[model samples]
Target: MSVLLEVQGVTKTFGGVVANQSVSIEVRAGEIAGLIGPNGSGKTTLFNSIVGAHAIDEGSIKFEGEEISTFRVPVIARKGMLRTFQQTRIYGEMTALENMRISAPEARVSALSLLGGFSSKTDTRGEELLEFVGLASKRFLRAGALSFGQQKLLEFAMALMSEPKLLLLDEPTAGINPTLINGLIDRLKQANKELGVTLLVIEHNMRVIMNLAERITCLAHGEVLASGTPDEVRNDPRVVDAYLGAG
Candidate 1:
């Protein structure tokens, strides 16, 4: 698989504190990769830097071998990448279908375009994705009425509306009931295998990441500590020590 995203020697700081220090990692095309670490390990900071949420203090970020370190979020998103927050971001007042329609890049082309109409094709696709995420029955329901887990599913479908080539998900399984986790995992796998969307997932759930990701990268103190396949990362003494010591 070719490298889809690369972060080399990336660094970011706020005032005197360094949130990320020369951190580097890679995600390949057509694969689900996991980012794991204890709290304050700069996992989300790395994602923010890569997605142009903030300016990096140093190093480079490349998407499909093109330098995008200086690009802003909208530009990067237009290049077929987007991210979902740990807290679901949905329009509480809008129906799930309405949220999906507004999420398309075309709908966001301009402030005026938002008031303009959407095509039937977009509506059809929205329903398809809603069904894909098991929210078809709730398509017309207001987003705020859904449970937290359902809102996350709706957010996932919203991100898909843009047909992004790569999706960065931050702690996707957090704050969900254990019973629903398996179904969510299945949907994630389906999205990767059927929709051909590559995923870079930040997950604190050890078993979930171990089962979902093809490879895992672990961070410690804002730096790359270890990266490998699931078994390799799970058995690595450094990873064990980091988690244990954090405890």
Candidate 2:
């Protein structure tokens, strides 16, 4: 597969502390890639740089062959790339379907225009995605009322409303009930296979990432430590050492 996103020697520092130092990784098109690292290994820091949540100190980030390292979040998001947070993001007061409608890139609806803002087309697609994430019955329920797992599913559907070509998922299985994770994994696979959305997931759950991604990259101390398939990465002594040291 062709490379979809490339982060070459990227670095980021907060004040004087380096969060990522010479970190590099590549994610290919049409594949689910896993990014694994222990706490404070700069996993989320790298995601922020790639997704334009913050500026990188050095190096390059290219998506679909275009340099986007300097671009801001909205601009990058408009370019058919988007990301989901570990903590779910939704309008707590809004109903699930209402949140989905507003999530569309075209929505731009004001607080006063809530019910009248969405067109029938947006409504239909929103409902379909709600069903896709197994939230059809919760359509009219307030987003904040949903359980954490359900809220994450709602957030996933919201991201899909934009049809992102590449979706960066940060700790997708975190905070989710173990029983719900399998269903979440299935939805992620379905999104990749059926909707043609590529995924780059940052996960601490070893079992989940191992099962989800075709390839994996591991980072430690803000640098790339290993990169390969599930078995290869799992067997790398450097990777094992990093995790062990983290604990």
- Candidate with the greatest TM-score versus the true structure: 1
- lDDT string for model 1 (52-152, tens) is 99999999999999999999999899899999998788899999999998887787567776786778999999999999888999999999999999999
Q: Which ten residues in a row have the lowest lDDT in candidate 1?
A: 107-116
Candidate 1 global TM-score: 0.96
Alpha-carbon local distance difference test for all models: 0.93, 0.92
List clashing residue pairs in candidate 2. none
The segments of candidate 2 whose C-alpha lies over 4 angstroms from its true place after superposition are: 108-117
Q: Mind giving the per-residue lDDT tens digits that candidate 2 earns over 204-226? A: 99999999999999998888899
TM-score of every candidate relative to the true structure: 0.96, 0.94
In model 1, residue pairs whose N, Cα or C atoms come closer than 3 Å (at least 3 residues apart or on different chains), thus clashing, are none
